[model samples]
Target: MGPFVRRYAMPLTFLGLFAAVWMVQALVLPPDARRAVIAWASTNLENLAVNPVGTMVASAFVAEGAQGVLLVVAAIGLFPVTRRFGNLRAVVLVAASHVLGTLISQGIALVRLQAGLLSESIRTIPDVGPSYVLCAALVAAFLYGHGRVRRLLALAGWCALVPVLLDGLLALEVAAVGHLVAMLAGGLIGGLLLLLERRRVAVPEKMAAEPVAGA
Candidate 1:
């Protein structure tokens, strides 16, 4: 691979795919058609309860307006995180964050609905976005962030994005909590993966240094 591609393959691949889907939604489809498509593909409580697997994948690609663009931009900026932790670890962390975040938030909403704390309308409320994955990636980046300045910058970026993700609405306050849970989950998972990788590497090294049983 070329130097540029080697350095940025992850972000470029993700951004290209996301931009293609987002552009089709923005330019090709009419507003009503787009909304219908979004509704059908959303990971809201009702939709998720019905179609958990597909919506988890679909919903990550359904950002609205500038959201999709910003997600790609952020992905590019944080692409180093992929390099730092290795692509598999980064992808797993992000995927887990998105899936777990959605499940946790919707689970809480279900409980509230059952207790009459939230409106039944929440079951069908539109909940598609790249926010969960992005939030998780950001948290993982923070964990891998090296210097004091890098860590502070990662944290500042997260704080700035949280209100936008939750839309600053009082009713959706639980979402902020859900995002926090996802971030913490990402950090924990990232740490564990790193620990496991270290142990895996150490085991072979220790065996190589030890004398053979018969030799």
Candidate 2:
């Protein structure tokens, strides 16, 4: 039981729970509820669309999840990455982080810290998926990863294209806050993954030369 919990069950549990929650909250909200929420969010989205003011509180909340997941991914990619806490720890940590983020986001929304109705069509929508995505890039860079670092980076580079796509999708309309939240979450997650990995990864050439030169 202990072994199973640590090895496969933990990570699987975390990923599974996270995927389910995100699907329900971000992707699969009740249709009527989703439409209403989207309508409200789109308003603030427009206000920041053109002259872009600031990120919605919800985006910041989502950023927390991105941070948490990427942090764990970075840890996993650590060469000596220890599974000291086992898979349970990793699973719990990521799951808790995401859940906490959602709670915070909802709390803020309830309080109306967000932008209210914008022009006619402006709306705010939270796409919290980017957090996991950028973390996946980190997972690629250091760990066995899905592919090589270059490929992961190529994936990270997708952020650049996102704006263009959003532009087209919006008809050059504004969802500035919504996209800002996405970009901010994406950049932060990717940057941290790289930074943490760099700090931990050894400079093989440097280490090798140290011994040769000394000898």
Candidate 3:
């Protein structure tokens, strides 16, 4: 039990936090107050401009849709990545992807708004969710998960998420664009981490071999 908890600490903590936030959103807050909380936590253009770090970090923990399904998907996606790469790397991969995805997507929206393409109302469109982080984890796990079962779980998650994530991609919707970018970012970051891990392992093996050869 101890080892199991240590191994899955990152995913377990994230899920716990997610559930707490879900409860607050669903049960504690009234509808009007819930909207206010979500708006405050959202990574919308106005919020991002005012408080980028807070909104980006807060947004990933707030769900805008079916929380139950998202929770399942998050568990499937996050655990494999954490088990494969350890907690720090898993967090880095997902968090970096989330921030990068948000920035790029919102940057595009800003450009469009400036060019008179998007409505002024987009500045406060209330974009909050865990989808970006979950998408990144799914991509990383699918590409680099250790076991067949882990990889299959990630594949299943991707299939379930693709329709929803890519729904308005052609129209360049903010959330859709963010999810796509987060997936790509996750894959790229995963490749880099894998390379670094291989090099770290190789160096130790090389050092050990050099001592044997000299003896």
Q: Write the per-residue lDDT of candidate 2 for residues 1-215, one digit (tens) a residue.
A: 87655465644443455455445556667767755543333224343354222233233223213444533443343211123223433333333333343333333443343455233332344433334323333333333233465445534544444554245333323233233333344344444544655665557655765756555
Can you tell me which runs of candidate 2 are displaced by over 4 Å? 1-15, 18-30, 33-146, 149-165, 169-193, 200-215
- List where candidate 1 sits over 4 angstroms from the true fold: 1-10, 76-78, 145-153, 166-174
Query: lDDT values of the candidates?
Result: 0.74, 0.38, 0.92
How many residue pairs clash in each candidate at the backbone level?
A: 0, 7, 0
Q: What's the TM-score of every candidate structure? A: 0.85, 0.33, 0.96
As for candidate 3, its clashing pairs are none
**Predicted structure 2, TM vs. truth:** 0.33
Model 3, position 8, has a per-residue lDDT of: 91
Consecutive 10-residue window with the lowest summed lDDT within model 1: 168-177
Pitting candidate 2 against candidate 3, the one with the higher TM-score is: 3
Single out the weakest 10-residue window by summed lDDT for candidate 2. 77-86
lDDT of 1 by residue, 122-174 (tens): 88877777677777767777777556665666677787777666563356454
TM-score of 3: 0.96
Per-residue alpha-carbon lDDT of candidate 3 for residues 52-163, written as tens digits (9 for 90 to 100): 9988888888886699998999998999999889999999999999999999999999999999999999999989889999999999999999999889989988998799
Judging by TM-score against the true structure, name the best candidate: 3
